[model samples]
Target: MKEKTPISLHEIEGVVVGHRDGHGFIVRDDGQPDLYLPPNEMRAVLHKDRVRARIVRHDRRGRPEARVTEILVRSETPIIGRLLYENGVWLVAPEDKRYGQDVLIPKGATGTAQPGQVVVVELTEPPALFGQPVGRIKEVLGDIDDPGMEIEIAVRKYGVPHQFSEGALAEARALPDKVRAVDRRGRVDLTDVPLVTIDGEDARDFDDAVYCEPARVGRGKGWRLLVAIADVSHYVRNGAPLDIDAYDRATSVYFPRRVIPMLPEKLSNGLCSLNPGVDRLCMVCDMLIDAKGEIHAYQFYPAVMHSHQRFTYTEVAAILQNTRGPEAQRHAALVPHLLNLHDVFRALLAAREARGAVDLETVETQIVCDEAGRILRIEPRTRNDAHRMIEEAMLAANVCAAEFIASHRHPCLYRVHERPSADKVELLREFLKALGVPLTVPDAPGPRDFQAISKATADRPDAPQIHQMLLRSMQQAMYSPHNVGHFGLAYEAYTHFTSPIRRYPDLLVHRVIKALLKDGRYHLPVLPVPGEALAKLAKRLQERGTSEAMTRSRGRPSQEVLGWEAAGLHCSANERRADEASRDVEAWLKCKYMREHLGEEFTGTVTAVTSFGLFVTLDSLYVEGLVHITELGGEYFRHDERRQELRGERTGVRYTLGSKVAVQVSRVDLDGRRIDFRLVRDDAAGEARPSGAGTGEPSARRGMAASSLRSAKRAGPKANSGKSGTGKATPARATRGAGKAAGAQSPGSGRGRRPRG
Candidate 1:
């Protein structure tokens, strides 16, 4: 009897990630390698749709190719796009190119939106094999050129909760405008203590205040530091309307000129904010640090504080620089207190260096905007001693919070950052070796090892690039119940104990601390709304392949542990969501800013090297754009993955990270958020000229150069077409152009400092 043919199909479940070029990828739920879905398989699905797919076969390079077998869930997110009327048919083209297909709008469904106006559309029907998705206009967001339109689009696109629920708003409105006598009954009265809040000039919400004094610790001189954080838990009770809203938002999203707060303005800006000369309830971390900067003793307590003064970072820096200066004379009474704080900061910094913490400095730019929300210019934000002083104080309190919860055997979310994976370490080693840098990585690396490499390469011309690579190799920090420790800060335990007014995780920490103080357990109650939804999304984003390993390490977790894990996951996902939304708004603004300088020439340094092109950051504008491979002369170029460079085969000219090159702006696509550049060749020296030599005028040959570049790109490369030097298929075109060009941090409310972890 002839045996049945062996079945070779392997089914996998994953989320669809669409590309601008119509192809897509299935990011497996199991955390395995992603499966490539050709353009045909993506026709029936949109971005972020979950589905079950059968792997038909593997390519020659061992990459899996899949076909969709079943649709699990269609995304419920509303699409944000520009309404277009073409050939007598109404349609909406998604601002996010990953959607791949336009949504068809029926004649009556197009609300009050004009043809070219941006609008939000709710899908009425999902896409089929031969049909497009259909949607109805739900909201009109005004014209494309309207001021603050980018932020409006970003909030909706990332599913950011911008508006507070009615119930939440009612609860906030019912709260007292100031801390009352009844509220101070159970709290220690620290109103007599001369504490102050130092933050950025633009800071609106003051979450923390600090004070320091000299003390005696075991026959040695020490400092007593008090960090007071806004007591948000005192007002936002568990399972309350305010609590639900805060949990849904998870964190506040900061944009260029706006902020979508987690709590209502009544609480975030007025009631909970520790504004100067106001009676505010707070949770204080009172600590005794020895001369060596080690925390000798600590205690947590609720207190009523009256901020003596409000100081900006710039003002504080000036005062500290010259004690007898006019700025210090204005606050002569608080000058000594500031000096004490500075003393403690120095000791803490010494301890940090001794412990071998990873401190990679990066250039963070702040956008200067006009009254109409147009970009005036971009400037690098300068950090001063005042910023570091407050940061160190907050870090110490966070560490104490983590230790306090762990000591009580209570479950809480710990900010954990694991070591780099093996593959990432190997890749980093290969890159360093190719650059002839002397470094040795251990089998199990730690934060100190990475810091050592940074110090050794501090004098190198490519130090910035090397430091960035090190930062990228590290894993992202996330909240988790399991204490894996933070690799970057070299801390055995850490948690967010500051900024409860803005971050939900810090509020949870406060509740846990309060419960421990009362000798009672803080049981996470069942949330009234979106509990299951939050848990599900958190599991999808956080569990990946770690769930099995967690089960293996420890038997099945109890229900309490499970609840904490879900909360951690939800908070982590929302943090990432907030970051992405902020970045998206910034990118849109930068694209708009670059459109006015389309034909100007500028010298820039290569910030990133990829298979398709080099990402160059302009010296004066501080803006980044792409220099496509085809624009790098006529010789065939091959991408070296290990060295992160592109080398020409005929002339052996290489363009690697940190290389300086002159390029003229060739094209700007505001819709695509892309800026393309053409290399400006120095025919006399056959090398790139130094920056500042550009005439800064619109180039006359800009159109001719753009046309030539496009023609060459269409003809494709002569050799190594569709492949890298390692014989791997070139990555998706969308991966190379999007998100890399316009990367900048938003001007956040004094919370822009890198997290301690």
Candidate 2:
């Protein structure tokens, strides 16, 4: 052991950060940065392995310093995530932290795991003599069950996919794809129907088509709207490859960069995609509605349509708004019809409003990435009128489809959103009462009830908070063969009859629509065999969920975390990964871009608060960076999770998520995906008033101060002391870049302050 080492401090265990030349782990000693764990001695240690280590040699650079004397814990594990048969051997690769090397299962222990299948494994023996670690297969998941399955596998292998299957793929490749002449013999051949598909500029697969014309109801005073959807089942018959894949997927997985479609490309992109000018099959919902948006007459049929024009929402909106320039003229023939469509949409919107449909208008951030999958920027994409207009049309069409299917006495999967859980409702009720917010909830407050409550608290200062709470109190919608009216849409009946390319349920609905039109009975999907590898996947997912649910009750720790149900936790974790990956790619690009401005000032919002630091969200560019709370001022700042605030001891000023402040770029960590910032007064933030500061609603920045609190360090620099080497404070001018009044200094202001390297 090295002499002069701080004696009697807790014998700190070492954590392996990296490995070198089969020698051992490169461990780090926390308190002292200039020390590391040498190899050969660290053979038992692994990455993230905590060990009892002591200082042997302190390098001048302060790292490469320690020798691990004992392995406090074994880092190897039995349960592994990615075990499969490879090169005549069963190899188990774990998908967890620590990233340990793969374990090879003996040929004698092959069990049920197949080549190219995702299976869990258990290590029986550790690696020896240059041979891999050994294990046996525990379970296997079927070939990534479509889109949802891929995500599930990806997340799980990451220790996170939150989805379930209904034994749908068990009945695979049993049916045909193309509609036979015998199949078409009984169905209506509405090949001449003037149905057109309206989608986005980038849409590839068209699911539903519409043919709306003027009609009179209630004594000829209302207009009749016809909503026709692509009859997908006509082409993709029961038990076909397309059907099997679709059913397995359950839903489409839409990644930011690409989509793993539920159906095969041959089917999703070719046979059933409903491309314009092609003679495509579809299930039609013909509804005769009045001016009051009530359906007076409706009919369901199996029909064929040659989509007249594949119109973009932008083009439709342009025609409807009468900005018929060259772009609108490109699709000139549909102008009058599109206008009539807008009229229908207007009426539907009114009906929706009258029904008290919630206008949940949260903007979504679209990530722009470069060729190498690095994020270019994060910007809010506009959901223009065209988007809403198409949405209204789809909603009406889905209602008509659901009503037609139900009226015909056929059973099908319904998109159902149940009322909030009893516990949630009770908690919300108590919370509302405490906040003095009056709400008249029925025995069960549905979407309309939530809407009423939101409207009541609209103008209140706590509107966002209340709205967020109420939103959280609602139950998420899910799919079931049971027909329960949708609560959120305020509809008596609803099913997804659109977007079959993205959702398997919608394709199933289309199948049922065709089945009923031809007078056929509904067939149940087949499930996996008992004790089969596939069954283990479903069972394993359930078990994984149970295990995770137990951990959620332990409460949260760090940032990028919220709640912990199996599904919720999985989604949250995946969301964090996605966000981090996106942020990493963006930060790399942004840092490369921001290198142009070394001493620039930018305005930002306080996005998060922690005991150690605050995260600031830049307003102009939307880039986020950390502002260590320790750098708040000369005095101590205390954090209060209850009030979501950080209070200054003497100034009494508080900072929270929405608190506005100008910050100067202090440092950047590209590989670590971090951008550091230091808070600046408006005067130092430059004349460019962050566009809108006071416009943002005030956050609850109410908290207590850390008055008279002392640092854990004997002589540490005060917060934001702008110091350099070994706790010497960086100069005020260099630290506060854009120029603000010099901050106050204390006894610990200039000496022994640590810069987070």
TM-score of each: 0.90, 0.60
Q: Please list the C-alpha lDDT of all candidates, in the order they appear.
A: 0.80, 0.55
- Give the Cα error of residue 660 in candidate 1, in Å: 0.9
Clash number by candidate, in order: 0, 21
Q: Which one is best on TM-score?
A: 1
Candidate 1 is scored at a TM of 0.90
lDDT tens per residue, model 2, 315-381: 7767766746876688777676677777777787888878877765543445555655555665765
**Candidate 2's C-alpha lDDT?**
0.55
Report the lDDT tens digits of candidate 1 across residue range 1-757.
3232222576878788887767788888766677788888889999989899988876655667889999988988789999999999999999988899999999899988999999999999999889999999999999999999999999999899999999999999899888887998989999999999998888889999999999998899999999999999999999999999999899888888898999999988999999999999999999999888889999999999999999998999999999999999999999999999999999888888889889998888778899899999877889899989999999999999999999997889999999999978987888889888999877688999998999999998778888988998899999988888999999999999898988989999999999999999898867533333443544444654446424435655456766777788788888999888877777778878877766666667777777676777876677777766556665566778778877767666677777777677766667666667767755576443323221122223322323444434433322111112233223322223332113221211112334432
